[model samples]
Target: MENDEMIIPELNNETIESMIYIIRGQKVILDFELAKIYGYETKRFNEQVKNNINKFPERYRFQLNKEELDIILRPKKSTLAKRILKNI
Candidate 1:
Protein backbone atom coordinates (compact mmCIF):
# COMPACT_ATOMS: atom_id res chain seq x y z
CA MET A 1 0.00 0.00 0.00
CA GLU A 2 1.10 3.56 -0.67
CA ASN A 3 2.09 5.76 2.22
CA ASP A 4 -1.07 7.85 1.90
CA GLU A 5 -3.33 4.84 1.58
CA MET A 6 -5.16 3.55 4.62
CA ILE A 7 -5.16 -0.05 5.66
CA ILE A 8 -8.37 -1.86 6.53
CA PRO A 9 -7.15 -2.62 10.00
CA GLU A 10 -8.51 -5.59 11.91
CA LEU A 11 -9.15 -4.20 15.35
CA ASN A 12 -9.91 -6.56 18.19
CA ASN A 13 -12.69 -5.80 20.67
CA GLU A 14 -10.17 -5.17 23.45
CA THR A 15 -8.24 -2.67 21.31
CA ILE A 16 -11.39 -0.82 20.27
CA GLU A 17 -12.74 -0.83 23.80
CA SER A 18 -9.50 0.69 25.10
CA MET A 19 -9.86 3.61 22.69
CA ILE A 20 -13.48 4.49 23.42
CA TYR A 21 -14.20 7.02 26.13
CA ILE A 22 -17.39 8.49 27.57
CA ILE A 23 -17.34 12.18 26.98
CA ARG A 24 -20.35 14.49 27.17
CA GLY A 25 -22.34 11.35 27.98
CA GLN A 26 -21.50 9.94 24.56
CA LYS A 27 -19.06 7.20 23.69
CA VAL A 28 -16.29 8.63 21.51
CA ILE A 29 -12.92 7.79 20.10
CA LEU A 30 -10.29 10.44 19.82
CA ASP A 31 -9.08 11.34 16.33
CA PHE A 32 -5.57 10.14 17.13
CA GLU A 33 -6.91 6.73 18.08
CA LEU A 34 -8.85 6.53 14.85
CA ALA A 35 -5.76 7.54 12.94
CA LYS A 36 -3.82 4.68 14.52
CA ILE A 37 -6.61 2.25 13.72
CA TYR A 38 -6.85 3.29 10.06
CA GLY A 39 -3.13 3.92 9.40
CA TYR A 40 -3.07 7.67 8.89
CA GLU A 41 -1.50 10.59 10.62
CA THR A 42 -4.04 12.36 12.81
CA LYS A 43 -3.81 15.52 10.68
CA ARG A 44 -4.24 13.53 7.50
CA PHE A 45 -7.18 11.60 8.93
CA ASN A 46 -8.88 14.87 9.85
CA GLU A 47 -8.19 16.28 6.41
CA GLN A 48 -9.70 13.23 4.76
CA VAL A 49 -12.76 13.49 6.98
CA LYS A 50 -13.17 17.19 6.16
CA ASN A 51 -12.67 16.61 2.45
CA ASN A 52 -15.24 13.86 2.53
CA ILE A 53 -17.55 15.47 5.05
CA ASN A 54 -20.63 13.95 3.46
CA LYS A 55 -19.48 10.48 4.39
CA PHE A 56 -19.67 11.16 8.12
CA PRO A 57 -22.90 12.30 9.68
CA GLU A 58 -23.07 14.98 12.35
CA ARG A 59 -23.40 12.35 15.06
CA TYR A 60 -20.11 10.80 13.96
CA ARG A 61 -17.97 13.88 14.33
CA PHE A 62 -17.49 16.80 16.68
CA GLN A 63 -14.72 19.07 17.90
CA LEU A 64 -13.47 19.15 21.44
CA ASN A 65 -13.77 22.45 23.23
CA LYS A 66 -11.10 23.48 25.74
CA GLU A 67 -13.04 21.95 28.64
CA GLU A 68 -13.69 18.75 26.78
CA LEU A 69 -10.05 18.58 25.77
CA ASP A 70 -9.12 18.97 29.41
CA ILE A 71 -11.49 16.23 30.40
CA ILE A 72 -9.88 13.87 27.92
CA LEU A 73 -6.33 14.80 28.80
CA ARG A 74 -6.72 15.13 32.57
CA PRO A 75 -7.02 11.48 33.49
CA LYS A 76 -4.09 10.39 31.33
CA LYS A 77 -1.18 9.37 33.54
CA SER A 78 1.41 8.76 30.86
CA THR A 79 4.05 11.31 29.98
CA LEU A 80 3.88 9.99 26.43
CA ALA A 81 0.14 10.60 26.23
CA LYS A 82 0.58 14.15 27.50
CA ARG A 83 3.38 14.77 25.06
CA ILE A 84 1.45 13.32 22.16
CA LEU A 85 -1.62 15.38 23.03
CA LYS A 86 0.44 18.54 23.36
CA ASN A 87 2.22 17.95 20.04
CA ILE A 88 -0.98 17.11 18.24
Candidate 2:
Protein backbone atom coordinates (compact mmCIF):
# COMPACT_ATOMS: atom_id res chain seq x y z
CA MET A 1 0.00 0.00 0.00
CA GLU A 2 1.10 3.59 -0.58
CA ASN A 3 2.17 5.54 2.50
CA ASP A 4 -1.13 7.46 2.48
CA GLU A 5 -3.02 4.18 2.11
CA MET A 6 -1.35 2.46 5.07
CA ILE A 7 -3.92 0.81 7.30
CA ILE A 8 -4.55 2.45 10.65
CA PRO A 9 -4.78 0.50 13.85
CA GLU A 10 -8.33 -0.50 14.74
CA LEU A 11 -9.88 0.07 18.13
CA ASN A 12 -10.37 -3.29 19.84
CA ASN A 13 -13.49 -4.43 21.71
CA GLU A 14 -11.98 -3.40 25.04
CA THR A 15 -11.34 0.12 23.74
CA ILE A 16 -14.92 0.35 22.50
CA GLU A 17 -16.20 -0.81 25.91
CA SER A 18 -14.04 1.74 27.70
CA MET A 19 -15.40 4.54 25.47
CA ILE A 20 -18.97 3.56 26.40
CA TYR A 21 -18.08 3.64 30.10
CA ILE A 22 -16.51 7.10 29.80
CA ILE A 23 -19.53 8.56 27.99
CA ARG A 24 -22.11 7.26 30.49
CA GLY A 25 -20.06 7.54 33.70
CA GLN A 26 -18.96 11.13 33.02
CA LYS A 27 -22.16 13.06 33.68
CA VAL A 28 -20.76 16.04 31.84
CA ILE A 29 -17.90 16.83 29.51
CA LEU A 30 -15.77 19.99 29.64
CA ASP A 31 -15.93 22.89 27.17
CA PHE A 32 -12.88 21.59 25.35
CA GLU A 33 -14.58 18.35 24.37
CA LEU A 34 -17.63 20.22 23.05
CA ALA A 35 -15.50 22.76 21.17
CA LYS A 36 -13.21 20.16 19.64
CA ILE A 37 -16.02 17.92 18.44
CA TYR A 38 -19.01 20.26 18.06
CA GLY A 39 -17.24 23.61 17.63
CA TYR A 40 -18.77 25.21 20.71
CA GLU A 41 -18.39 25.61 24.45
CA THR A 42 -20.58 23.69 26.87
CA LYS A 43 -22.33 26.95 27.79
CA ARG A 44 -23.00 27.81 24.14
CA PHE A 45 -24.17 24.32 23.44
CA ASN A 46 -26.60 24.59 26.34
CA GLU A 47 -27.79 28.07 25.41
CA GLN A 48 -28.61 27.13 21.83
CA VAL A 49 -30.65 24.21 23.03
CA LYS A 50 -32.33 26.35 25.65
CA ASN A 51 -33.31 28.97 23.08
CA ASN A 52 -35.02 26.21 21.14
CA ILE A 53 -36.40 24.36 24.11
CA ASN A 54 -39.45 23.21 22.19
CA LYS A 55 -37.26 21.52 19.62
CA PHE A 56 -35.14 19.83 22.32
CA PRO A 57 -37.96 18.81 24.68
CA GLU A 58 -37.80 17.94 28.39
CA ARG A 59 -36.76 14.32 27.98
CA TYR A 60 -33.73 15.46 25.98
CA ARG A 61 -32.59 17.81 28.74
CA PHE A 62 -33.93 18.57 32.19
CA GLN A 63 -32.57 20.03 35.42
CA LEU A 64 -31.40 17.65 38.09
CA ASN A 65 -33.76 17.29 41.05
CA LYS A 66 -32.77 17.89 44.68
CA GLU A 67 -31.89 14.24 45.27
CA GLU A 68 -30.06 14.02 41.97
CA LEU A 69 -28.15 17.21 42.70
CA ASP A 70 -27.34 15.90 46.15
CA ILE A 71 -25.67 12.89 44.56
CA ILE A 72 -23.87 15.19 42.12
CA LEU A 73 -22.60 17.58 44.79
CA ARG A 74 -22.18 14.82 47.33
CA PRO A 75 -20.37 15.54 50.59
CA LYS A 76 -20.73 19.27 49.95
CA LYS A 77 -24.22 19.54 51.48
CA SER A 78 -25.74 21.90 48.95
CA THR A 79 -28.76 23.99 50.03
CA LEU A 80 -32.15 22.77 48.83
CA ALA A 81 -32.79 25.96 46.85
CA LYS A 82 -29.40 25.84 45.14
CA ARG A 83 -29.82 22.17 44.39
CA ILE A 84 -32.99 22.98 42.42
CA LEU A 85 -31.15 25.29 40.04
CA LYS A 86 -32.38 24.78 36.47
CA ASN A 87 -29.98 22.94 34.21
CA ILE A 88 -29.96 23.88 30.55
Candidate 1 lDDT by residue in tens digits, 45-81: 8889999999999998898898877776767747537
lDDT of 2 by residue, 20-85 (tens): 312224444232233324545446666767798789765444454566555544544464234224
Query: Among these predicted structures, which one has the highest lDDT?
Result: 1
What candidate 1 gets wrong by more than 4 Å, as runs, is 1-11, 77-87
Highest TM-score, which number? Answer: 1
| Residue range with the least summed lDDT across 10 consecutive positions in model 1 | 1-10
**What are the clash counts of all predictions, listed in order?**
0, 0
Q: Residue 62 of candidate 2: its Cα lDDT?
A: 49
Cα RMSDs, all models: 3.3, 11.5
